[model samples]
Target: MAISFDRAADFYDQTRALPPEVADQVTECILRLSRATPETTFFEPGIGTGRIALPLVERGYAYTGVDISEQMMDKLRQKLVGKPHQLTLINADITTLPLESGVFDVAIAAHILHLVADWRSALAEIQRVLKPQGVLIYFHHPGSGATRNDPIDQQWRTILERYSYQADFVGAVTEDVLGYFQAQNLAIETVSVAELPRIRTAAEALQTYCDRIYSNLWQIPEPIFTPAIEDLKTWVQQTYPDLNERFESSYEVTVTAASRAR
Candidate 1:
């Protein structure tokens, strides 16, 4: 079963919020690949907590967001309370949303496609709402493709190896996004695919996994996970004795752009 965003909304931003720099990159990449101008009206499906919306709206873009979780939307509302802009949020599912046809200048599905069981339906809806020549963008933090040799990530992998690992947005990735774009006859373009370096303490990253902040964490059985956690903790102490020591990591972000036929 998919994890509920309402339950996850409490500390969602705390655990998984996009850094300000990353948010800016998303906005800039979308605009650079498409014909959207500063005044273009943008829509995002599954715009949880407005993480990606922040950068664009700050630049004076008109934005509309749709999501099923009232709690998630509520959190976004809190963030926007004193902020000013033309922002509208619909508390609804994307597939059945009653939004008008061909009205939006751009539509973004950042990290959202893989979660929808009926992703094709969601694609159709995105197609419906975008005007001819309108752009559709998908943003994703792809699965760790390059391989992480870091002890901590390796430890997690060892534990995960014991069982079949599957999580939310499991089957969704960049290739799926491209396939959908092609099926809909939208011209596809790769906007960005670059590695960003990051640093974090072993303890910090380990705690995030243990808390299962991401919905995928719940997919692992407790019996298997408990042992893995213990093993990881022991290994971390043996390797990085100082909990404050930071280690390097490479995070990859991918953005895909497509246009509705004019």
Candidate 2:
């Protein structure tokens, strides 16, 4: 079930009640890595709902963003009304971008690198449009690398490790990202890596698993998803007896910035 971020926009907007500062942090990372002078052009692939772009343009950076989902772009367009900054939003996949080469000064991919079929080709496409020394930053959040620290979370990890199926994309991490960027001849550098907070209940966390909230889980057959939940719940209750507690939700974000080789 390949998801168009447009179709997932409402679910995304509804489920996401992010900490206000998190958005600011994304903008700050871009500013720190890319020297955003007034004339410096910027591009974002899969810029769903302008999470980073909206705040970025407010600070006076020129913007060009591409996404496959028109519905998602439509939502982002509504927010750009009367804004005094340059924005060019195109409905296209980042892999086969219909843009000029060497025009952009910076390009950022937030939670998007892992979604592409051939991320190497996507990196090539991104590099095609970047000017010399252009900065490219990728934001990845490998949700809660939670191990045995919490019994219930450990169970969730256990079930996912056993059952979750992602057909094409898999295991996005900082090491793979750096290696890929280096293979593409981009100069890699670290930006900011931190764990960010969110809030969810024990039930909600389990629901995420059951409902296949994570895109990779969608590849798992419906029959398996439910049973995996049932198995996770039953075992947690029987094995970890007093382990139904809820905790503040959090995930780690690894931001790696790469420079286009001249």
Candidate 3:
């Protein structure tokens, strides 16, 4: 099943706002890939809240955004007021979008591939819809490779890999991503990196942030997860409250852009 973000849509935007450093990287890559122009027809699959689409539209680019979440689309719809550019919003799956072949100049999928059951299919869809030699810009947060050291973290990774390897966030490592594009004969044009998209100064702060943000997982009725959240929080507060203010975590991200073979 595709991961659902209906209830988390508002909270996700509230916690993370536009003009954030990370967002700048994502948007900058898109612009570079599109070689931004007035006639550029851009498509953003999983365009949450129009974060990137709205800005592109405002900048005079025509855009079409598609997402599976009605709630997210509703939020994006509310934010569409006063934008005087040609923008079309669709509620559909990226893997099975109803778009004409070779229609878009550039396609973007940001921080969303990991949530799909078959990311390759989405890539195929982008290939099918983008014009020959068109660009595809994608971003991923490879959660698996990030938290592999800790036992609990490693265990979580194992479970996810076992159950959702095909769709697991970061299903493709850097090499895997590069190989996939190369095999398709798509040229890798640019690579940009950003570490720790959201930074916490100390372990305690990280714990607190994780606690508040992941309350749902912690509050689950299941015995395993129920105690894990609170225990982690208490451990952080008691053992490394000072570290919470002194430590930092950088979430490394890579933005890859490739051109479909002509």
Better of 1 and 2 by lDDT: 1
Tens-place lDDT digits, model 2, residues 67-151: 9888888888888787777888998877789999999989988877667766666778998898878888888544345311444
The lDDT of each candidate is 0.75, 0.71, 0.66
TM-score of decoy 3:
0.79
Per-residue lDDT value at 62 in model 3:
81
Q: Which of 2 and 3 is the better model by TM-score?
A: 2
Query: On residues 95-155, what C-alpha lDDT tens digit does candidate 1 reach at each position?
Result: 7767999999889887776667677778889878987778888876455323334567766
**Per-residue accuracy of model 3 over 62-147 as CA lDDT, tens digit each:** 88888888887788778767657687888888889898899988888776776665778887898888888688887654544463
Each candidate structure's TM-score, on Cα atoms with residue i matched to residue i, is 0.86, 0.83, 0.79
lDDT of 1 at 132: 77
Q: Report the alpha-carbon TM-score of model 1 versus the true structure.
A: 0.86
Worst 10 residues of 2 by lDDT: 141-150
Clashing pairs in 3: 196-250, 196-251, 201-247, 202-243, 202-244, 203-244, 204-244
Error of 2 at 37 (Å): 1.0
Best by TM-score: 1
